[model samples]
Target: MTTDTASPIPSDAEQFGKPLQGWRLRLYTIIFEADTRAGKLFDVVLIAAILLSVAVVMLDSVEALHQRHGRWFDVLEWCFTLLFTIEYIARLVCVRRPWRYARSFFGVIDLLAILPAYLAALVPELHLLMDVRILRLLRIFRVFKLTEYAIEYRLLSRALANSRRKILIFLSFVLMVVLVLGTLMYVVEGPEHGYANIPTSVYWAITTLTTVGFGDITPQTNAGRFIASLMMLLGWGTLAVPTGIVTAEMTSMRRRPVTTRTCHACLTEDQAADANYCRHCGAKLSPYQYDREEEQPVRR
Candidate 1:
């Protein structure tokens, strides 16, 4: 008789359960990946919940509505808080390194979105600051979670990043101009003419430069008015500098080809498809091959 030996196949419990595998993998995909139908559905529903919860929070702020529907508002808020709590727990459960996700920008935002209501419930005296619930509004950024699925947002983000230094310099120049103008206006108009001090004059210069025209403070002297007019003129030009810088960067980025492959190490998406390295973090990237014959030129 011949003896035969065969090895047993490992179960999912043995693989995924040990290190971010199994049901956790499926949960992670549904919660974080936009490429799959299930993931997309999850995002859509989550966004809807965020919007609805924000709307309820807004209505709860109105005194008349709060007095009449206070109980209903409390119920809705608790329900939304519970949903977000579950989502936060799910995210932690699915990740191999939960702290990494917890420390990420969106992870912190997700926690803030639910914390205010729970805090208010636990500390009734803190109800006065219920407006903190409005921080949940940051959840609107969750829409960016879909950026990995789009090319335009990727290019836009890249262009903004490229233009950051130029924009910062322009903003610094604007701040210097405002400081100079504010000091001059204070000297020209003096405290008697409603230019109370340097700080107050700076406030006036900022409002005028931004064209907010609050009308609370007005220059009473001819010299101050002239200075205000010049600042106002400069503001229009200042507003365009960052725009032009970003647009120029965007033009250059648009001319280049893009890829949808996300970086696993940095979790960054939208690298150039043919790139051997991530443009954002310089991590290694694997390019997926496409059928050149079937690929058509993309028109901007």
Candidate 2:
């Protein structure tokens, strides 16, 4: 190969269609820290933010969320949003291939995470919707960016995308359950028992099922407590649904492992046509060779 030092190695964004060097890479790395580690971190942060946001919501309803504007919590949340905003921008640059990156699924994820903050900032009125964390939290998938570049990960991605509808249906069913339970809890516990509204109570149901108890609300009535206990037990299965769905798909599409090295007895490396056996050392190289050879016209 002729060397051309004069030729600037295409930027990493140019080389692998992503920039892994420069300040942009650094920023993105800090955001991810590991394989989807950045995304995982983002998940942890957002999870915290959402929990905090939810707490704030419930506290506001129950008149409990604020103790001096939650100075530390507020500071932490702003820091997280700022970090994510920087990460979002850095990734756009890291994915210097605007068209390629933008069209990609994870590219969309990266776009989604930060858009809300900006939207909230741009239009203060919409700020009210900022803490609607459930829907917006899908932005956490941007962490998939950490693994998006690998060829091996394609199987996992394909599996998830293929099974998405089924997973969605399952989740939908869970939502229905939550809705029903929320309504029941609200009615049974009454407005004063912390099931203030159906939706918030439904959120409480989801939190309970996912075992993410934030301790924000409790069923004050004995009957409501009994129902809540049953729901809590049932949550184990509800929480496992998505995992089970994905695992089953993964098992079904499991790739067969192929040995790259030829067997020593065969002395063949994925035998080519006309190959009878090892050219250097004769061996039974034709287990499937006979079958393959039969498919081809034999030279007389």
Top model by lDDT, which number? 1
- lDDT: worst 10-residue window of model 2: 4-13
Report residue 139 deviation for candidate 1 (angstroms). Answer: 9.3
Tens digits of per-residue lDDT, candidate 2, 1-300, equal 854122222322343253445665555443423223454465466445545543443443332344655555445545655765665566666555656656666667666655654665577655465554443344455445545444347557756876787888998998898889888888898778777888888888888878788999988889988988989899888878888887777665554332222323422233343454565456644333222213444443
Per-residue lDDT, model 1, residue 175, is 88
> What lDDT score is found at residue 211 in candidate 2?
79
Cα lDDT, all candidates: 0.71, 0.58
In terms of TM-score, the best-performing candidate is 1
Give residue 195's lDDT in candidate 2 (0 to 100): 78
Identify the runs in model 2 with alpha carbons over 4 angstroms from their true place: 1-101, 106-144, 256-300
Error of 2 at 235 (Å): 0.6
Candidate 1 global Cα RMSD: 12.9
